[model samples]
Structure formats: C-alpha cells, structure tokens
Target: MRNFEKNIKNKAYAFQLDPMPDSFDKVMDALEKKKKRRFIFWLWILIPGFLIAGGGLLINQMYSSANAQVQAQSLKASHLLTVLFKENKQGLVHEDKYALTETTHTTTPENKMNNRPTSETQSLASKNNQPVFIKESSNQSAEFNNRNEKSFVQIEEKTNMTQVPSREKWTPIIFSNPYFVTFPTHSSNPVYSRTQIPFTKSTLPVIKSNSHQTGRWSIGIYSDLGVSKNIFINNKDSAGFGYTNARQLTDKFLFSYSAGIQFRYSPVKWLAIETGIGFTHYESNQLLSNAGFSWTTSGNNNDPDTALTLSSVDPQSAFGPYEYQNVYDYISIPIKVYYQKKWNWTGIEAGGGIIFDLPVNTHSYVADENSNMSYLRHEVKTSRLNVFGIQASANIHLVFHIKKFGLFAGPTFKYRMNSMFDKNYITRQHNYFIGGEMGLRYHF
Candidate 1:
C-alpha cells in the first residue's frame, strides 16, 4: 500500500508539472476576452444612458421656454384689444346742425291810442354782443293804415346768428308770406358758431397707456438651489511629493445654495443688463482609497507648511475608506445680459454671464471607515486650489408680471472657465453646477 501511494503521489506531481492542453488554453483566453467584452458593453450602455438623460433635460427646458413665450404674447394681445375697445366705447361723437327762424306780431297801447298808422322798429343784441335787425312787411303796414290803427311786426332769424355776416350797410327786404322762426339749442343752452366762439372745451375721456410697455430699471432678490461637482486635473510638475503616489480622488454631488440682490437696467423692451452680489454655500464630498500625509499645526498659526506628518505608517493603514468633506462659503458677483420677450402679463427671458466668486471661508475634514473624524483642517493647502475665482453660466426664466412687479423662476447651468487652483498645486479643480433659481422683481 505504501508503494502504491508513492506511485500515485509521483503521478500527481508529474501531472502538476505538465503543460495544459491547447484547447484548455484557448478556453481560458476566450473567457478573459469575454470578460473584457462584457465590461465594454456595460460601459457603452451607461454612457448612452447618461447622454439620453441629459438630452431629455435640455429638450424639456427648451419646450418650457417656448411655451412661456407663447402664453405671454397671447396674454398681451388680449389685454391690448381690451384696452382699445374700452377707449373706443368712451369716445365722443359729434352731430350735424340745423337752421331755425322765428316771427312775432305786436300791437302796443300807444299805437292803438294814436289811431294813426305808425311803423316802429326795435334793436336787440345777442349774448355775443352782435346787433340783430328785424324788418316788417309793407303789406302789414298797409293793413294797419286801412284799419287806422298803429301796429308793429318783428321777425327773428334764429340761424346760428353768430354765423351771419356783419353788414355795415342796412338794406330793407320784403316777405309776402308770413314766416315762423325756430332757434337751435343744445341741452337748453344756445349753440354758437366757430366764428363767435372764443374757446372750445373737449368732453372726451382720457385713457392711460400701459406702463409695462416702456423700459425701466428693476431691482430684485434671488435665491438658488442646486447640485455641484468638482473635476480635478492632475499636473506632474505641481503634484507635491506624497501626491505623486496618491490614488485618484472621486467626488459626488452635494447641496449648494445662494441668495443675493440684483439690479437690472433695461434700455429696450427686449434687452437688459444685470449685476448683483450674493452669498453662496458650496459643499462637496470626496473619497480617497489610499491614506496620505496632510499638513497640520500644533497651535494657531498662519504658516501653511509649518508641520507635515503621516497619520499612520502601516501599509495596512493606507488601505482606507477615507472620506473628505469640503465646505466653502463665498461672496459672488455676477454680470449678465438678458434678452426678453414680454406679453401683457408674462415674459420669457434668456441670459448668459460670468460670476466672480470671492471665498470667505473654507473648511475641510477627514473621516475613517468607522465614521470617526480623524482630522479637522482649515485652509488645507492643496495644489491649484483657487479659493476665489470666476465662472460662466447660462439661464432661462419664466416671468409672471403684476403691474410693476415680476415673479420669476428658471434653470441655470454653470461652467468653470478658469482653474480653481494655482499652477503650483498637484491637482487643479474645475467646478460645474446645475440649479433652479427663483426671484421677485420690482420695476422703477
């Protein structure tokens, strides 16, 4: 039995030393190739998924912007039509004029007592201080003579008396037939012609134009909420000693908020320039798989490199689920130009601009796998870290107008145009953000 076991052991040792068959080698190679192919397949799927989602978001934003413009224009047109109708309804209408005539016959007591035919004339003046002449017919005078009694006849012309020409010479005229006179009046008031009128008064209603149609200055308060991420660009020249071997850092989105006061100057109905200062809070969380040395100090000091040491020396300690939390507070100023289309009670606006970020404070911390805080560092010196900087952004907004006030809300996209860190830093940082902003605007 010992000899048989020895033989079996020898056989096993020989088998272990022998080379694998070609088919088995080919199968192993194929498995490795399949693994790579599966990885690439999944990568392709994920990339397109992200792209599709981003495209969908862009499409939605565009659709909403266009819809808002349409609605605003419709509202404006309706309001304009209503105003025009009201003005027309309140307009004044003029009426045409008609001529009038009057006749009168009178017998005075003196004329009757004289028992003799006598002709008497009386002169009268109108409110305009114009003299009027009245004449009696000769036939009436003959009748009075035949009766041996005195009589008088008066005929009044009531055509706009002011329109009648003023004659320096008086001429006598006869009318065989008796005539009646009628005077034209408006609401019991005598009407006068343009020649006699000293002044004219208007009785039309006054309509005020819409104030929103004119351009003006506006002031507003704005607030934003969003997600932000940082991208690191590695530089061999600026990467410090330990950072050369430092594992790649990965970051995730965190909450960001900003609030500010803005001033806008609109020179035309479609264009405006805006500027403002605001307070911003930005937070980001990063993960480092490898442990590294960080600069620290024993006491309160301004020196950035006064002390440097590794937290742990053991290689096992280097394999860590280390977490870094960064919080930055900034005072930001923005300059922008906007193009707007407004309707009666609404408007849509699009704008692009640069923002200047002035850092007020920066706080950084590290935590271990057990969620224990390892270090609290203020102003940790990192390569190429720009505490204050500038960035570019674009925005689209929908506005609801109420008299002199406007309420607005929109989506804003920001891109870092310059590196946030200096050239001496090992890693350069560029930050981008997507956010929603809301605000109230007052016009002057």
Candidate 2:
C-alpha cells in the first residue's frame, strides 16, 4: 500500500510538471491576433470599397445628366423641323391651287334673232384673228349697207357688250342680241389651297372619374364573457353565507349575447362601435360551513331541554355538511364601444362598459337534507335582482368577410360588478363561486 501510494504520487507529480501549452493562453493569443487583423484589414477594405462605390454613383449621375440634356436638345430640334416642313408644304399647296383657279374662267358672246330665227340662218362670227361672214345679200341697198356697217362697228367696238335689236325684213335682217359671249377656248382648272397650321397646346390623355368610393354601416351581434367577485370582503371574521371575507370567492363566468348596430369610419381602419341589449347569465357554486355556536336569552320557554340546547358545550353536532349551487340569470343591456387595430381584418380589442342587469332570478341548490333550500330563493323572490354591473375584457377576434357579412369568434372575460346572491343573508353561513363560458358574434 505504501508503494502503491508512492507510485500514484509520482505519476501525479509527472503529470503536473509536464511542459504543455495552456488552451486558455493559445485562445487569448489567437483572439488578440484576430482582433488586430479585423480592425486593420476591415478598415482598409471598407475605406477603399466605399470610395469606389461613391465614385461609381457620381459617374452614373453625371452620365445620366449628359444623356438627358442631349435627348432634350434632339427632341426640340426634331419638333422645330417638323413644324417648318409642315408650314412650307401648306403654303406651296395654297399658291398652286389659287393659280389654277384663276386661269380656268372663260367668257362668251350672245345674240337674239326674231324673223331670221324662223329660218335656218347661218351667220359667221370672228374670234381672235379668224373672220366669220353672214349670208346677207349685198343687193339690199346703201342704206341697209350703212346700217349693217354701223352695227358691225358697234359690235367690234364693245367685244363683251350685250345688245337687243328687233328683226324686220329677210332681205336685210335686223338682229336682236341679248348678250355678248367671248369664249377663251382654253382655260386652266381651279386650284385648292391649304394653309399651314400653327402649333397648339398639347395635353395628355385624361382618365375618367373614379367610381370606387364607398361608405358603410354594419349590423352585428356582440358578446363578452367575464368573471368578477360576488362579494367584496372587508373583514375576514364576519359571518356570511359565502366565501370567507378573508379568502374571496372568484366569479366563474358572466356571459352575455347581444345584437346591435356597428358603424365604420373610413380612412381610419379597425375603428368601430357596437351598441345592443344582451341576455347575461352568471353562475357560481360554493361550499359553506355553518358555525354551531348558538345563544338564547332567559325569556324563552323555561324547558330543561331548551336550556340544554342553549347552553350546549358542543353546538356543531346539530348540523350536517352541505353544498350550495348558486345560479343568476339576468337580462343585461350592454353598450360596448370598442376600437380595434386590425391586421388583415383579424386583431384584438380591449373594452369595458356598464351592464345593467335586471336580475331575472337567482336559485341555490342545497347539498344536504338539513339545508334550508328555500332560504336564499325566498329572499330573491322578495327582492328581484336589479343590479348595476360592469365588465372589462380583452378579446382576439377573427373577422370573416363573406360578401357583406362578418363572422367572429374569440374568448372573452366578463365579470358582474355586484354579487349574484345578496351576501347579507341573515341565516346562511358562507358563499363561494367558480365558472366559465364560450360565445360567438356576427356582423353585417
């Protein structure tokens, strides 16, 4: 054993003295070197890289500006060229059409014959440098000749003049002329002129008016489920037919269902209000223990057994354990004004409001035969529960948009402001309660 101990000690000593690098020291050296490279190398890389990026951005902007200026100049030149060409073409067309029209008109002479017109009278007329002769005999006379000469002179003097003369004899017929017509034979056609149009202000296409604006009001059913204390306890030692004043009885559930109007204001989404009357039901159950201490004054019946009962050493033996089931049904009117910030029509809301409950009724079921099953019921009948109440709860809502309707489902916590059972029961010992509910809501 001594040798064994010495061998172990020798091995331990060898291991302790071995020359080896500590992992912590190596790690610290590596970390320090990495930190040094990170600061120096990263800074070196980032400074140059950022400078390059900024330079590239500046170059891009300069190039874009130059290109835009060139494009603008080109567009302006093209527009001016188009306008000039259009005006020049229009003016040339107008001049050509007007010249053609002016050269196309002609004039003609007119003559009217009476007696000579009864027969086929072939007359010769002269135009330009051609001569036209009529078949009137020279055998008429000098007077007739003179008259004919005079008429010829008159006709030659006024080329476009109109004359009216009556015809008498065939040997030397006097002609009646209504108009003088001069035919040009060749005339140019009329020309149509087109004028250059001036530039007018240009406008982009305008879209028609929009028809997408809308206003909406919805009808819906809203509900809340909550729980509140039935009786607020001030002193723990006080006698009562409910949970001890020290340890309070929590309300299980006060669920309400109502139908009301829902309204929405646009631009501010997820904001709305609901108003309606609801049927609210609240129920609670508790186990109550009766105190066996009793006292009677000396003025009572002087029977010996009565004295024994009054002065009993163990008064708890007179009663059995019992359970109480409390139920409250009320017609509640709830005006809940809630606001919601919705994410895709699904969100959460927190609201609190007053619930006016006309206590329809309250019933208590005693667990044992010795229990005064009608004690609490008789009290309710005497004074129907007209209680002012308040409930506060938060709910996660799922809004389903089906055409113009909405369906929602979520959990809610509702509490009655006042206790269901009048805790001031003269004969009951203690009251305790616990409950929960589920509900649905619809919107239109």
- Best by the lDDT measure: 1
Best by TM-score: 1
lDDT of 1 by residue, 248-295 (tens): 234667667788999999887678899999998887764433333432
lDDT of 2 by residue, 60-86 (tens): 333222322332332222211110001
* Each prediction's whole-model lDDT (CA): 0.48, 0.32
lDDT of 1 at 348: 87
Candidate 2 whole-model C-alpha lDDT, 0 to 1: 0.32
- What lDDT is reached at residue 358 by model 1? 85
Enumerate clash totals for all models, in the order shown: 12, 27
Give me the runs in candidate 2 sitting further than 4 Å from their true place: 1-215, 222-231, 236-243, 246-268, 288-319, 343-348, 364-378, 419-444
- In Å, residue 79's CA in model 1 sits off its true spot by 19
TM-score of 1: 0.45
